[model samples]
Target: MAFREGGAIGTALGFYLIVVSILSIGIGPDLAILSKIAPGVLWGTLLLSALLSVDRIFHNDYEDGTLEVIALGPLPLELVAVAKATAHWISTAIPLVLMAPVLGMFLNLPAHGFWVLVVSMLAGTPAVSFLGAVGAGLTLGLGRGGQLLSLLILPLYIPVLIFGISTMDAVLVGPGSFSTSFAILAALSLATVVLTPFAAAAALRMNLQ
Candidate 1:
């Protein structure tokens, strides 16, 4: 599927960047530039990859009747949305986290930077999933929902993206600090927790009726 392909491209690109960095041992400034900017690059690529993968969250279910049953189930729709998004986070986001070590190493990240990437991504990807749900819900019935999805989710992801990058960036080049960025990442995740479900549920209801 296109959604899976998008995620694959993202994962592939991240690793490709790493390989390029290593191969550039004496060829150019590739490793140096990657080291200086790798955290942001890593998080940004992961976010994009995860975002692209979310397009399938409800597309098939809605086209069939599964979403209808889910909607009418005893449990709240928001909870269902949360569950689906959590699954998505596990599949897409977890891979990115696992790959961070390789990426950090390629970027010449500080010895401790890998830890920072893992912790921050663990907290951040859920938010990406949560927010992507809203986008998915909004574009649920559109033929070109994927395009709209990117437009909607990108702005919402900025906060998480910023904090995630900042946390790892600090590990690589700053004062060895993380409290502030980590708090911001947690806050962004919390904000999505509060805001996305209402929109996702409302969109689903509209599409159903």
Candidate 2:
């Protein structure tokens, strides 16, 4: 409701599609090279797309005092953080994950790599959401922290981005490499899922106090 109420849904989608469209055009009509760089380009764009709304994760709730109420709820704040991140993922990242294959077409992705792309994104995007929660919590109530959030969070996003692209690249190498890369990507997601909620909740408490 906050996302729709604030009109950020359009902003997030626009930022994502526009960045992707530009990259597709800038790379020109060369399908071969496009295929070579597609994974990185797509991953990079997804990073930026996720960044577009990271600040919004806690901004509205913090502004309207819902966060403090959430803090006082019977549920642990860490779980609240998880809920926030989960909402962001469902609203923002999942759409991108679903659209990746269509966007992959612009990059001339091979038929085999399409499923790899989808699987890699499925494993990686949850990390993006979870990590963004930490950043959002840290920067809570900073009306202008979108840029700062990007700076603070982009570094943390590197591992997911690297492994996500590698997961796709692994497709060309064989089953072993593919599984290895995908496993690492899954591990990253699991780690963030387990750890970031606590970190984000702590940050929220700091701001609340």
Candidate 3:
């Protein structure tokens, strides 16, 4: 489904690159300043890029009654939600994560920080997809749900963002340990993966009714 919607992925990647490029240019040629801010900027841009296609996670299926059909299947709705969210992580978040290293070059990210940035984002982005599934399911059929979904989901993304950046900063220059922060970030992803399916499934049921 994601590949069929190539424009969405392309738009997200384009947006990611453009935002990083603009910020790099706007911040000027100062490698020190760029490196200092690179982790935060890359992570922020990644979150926004992932969000671009989130509303569409269930929208197409919901609109065409496919969701109802799927709900009637033997597999439970929670599992269905899990599948949707997983697909989203693979299609959307993975691409953005892959692009982060290249973007890091633009921002003059410290060599050591590059590996940490990628690892941190990998450990953290699953929460974005899973938690975002809840928002997408809630706003399933609502018009202009994208705006509301952003409001609903971005707050939930805070912990992931905080820990994600913290993990990178710890590696680059920090008072904290990378292992501790990365552990927390990974825990956030694991928790969301375990718990969000139920919330998303409930929302999907309400909207389907």
Candidate 4:
């Protein structure tokens, strides 16, 4: 509603199409084709869906004064940045989780992979949000920051997205060794967990001034 009310019609539409297509995938004569295509489409949907909300973080809050108070707060600006970015992620990615059953239906994903998608998104979206914070921080006050934010964030997120979807795909394959990909996703998320706060806080502080 906010996305629509805010008038970013194109983005809202993209979000809708993604949700619809993922949910509406038919499951009948194309079981083999579905298995082959499911992993890529599921992964692609996650990436595209997440990208929609990254720019709104700093861009919206910066316009208001909330970002300033947060930057100047005593609890360490980076920590605040991490928290803020996480909140942004929650807003965007949680909805995707709720929508996962739809994507799962299309893939005919097993019960195990169904839960895996949930866990992977949980592990994965933090990387997206925080790294996006870096991009957002860099472009916090710029005239055309959204596209630049994508350029900055997409590279950082590839590994996170890959490992996450890879885990799901691996599950689809021969007995699925998810530990390795899962570990990489965890590592990436953890690394971002450590670093993005400070980076985002710096961007917030810079924008504040």
| C-alpha root-mean-square deviation, candidate 2 | 1.9
- Candidate 4 residue 117 Cα shift, in angstroms, is 1.7
lDDT of 2 at 112: 89
44-156: candidate 2 lDDT, tens digit per residue: 98888878887888888898888777778798989888888988888888888888788888888888888889889989999999999999999885768788888899999
Give candidate 2's TM-score: 0.94
RMSD for all candidates, in order, please.
4.3, 1.9, 1.4, 4.1
Off by over 4 Å in 3: 1-5
16: Cα error in model 2, Å:
1.8
The numbered model that scores best in TM-score is 3
Q: Compute the lDDT for candidate 4.
A: 0.71
Cα error of candidate 4 at position 120, Å:
1.6
C-alpha lDDT of residue 27 in model 3: 85
- lDDT for residue 43 in candidate 2, whole number 0-100: 89
The superposed Cα distance between candidate 4 and the true structure at residue 184, in angstroms, equals 1.6
lDDT leader: 3
Winner of 3 and 4 under lDDT: 3
lDDT of 2 at 150: 87
Question: Where's the lowest-lDDT run of ten residues in candidate 3?
Answer: 1-10
**Cα lDDT of model 1 overall?**
0.76
Collision pairs in model 4: 78-197
Q: What value does the lDDT take at residue 191 in candidate 2? A: 97
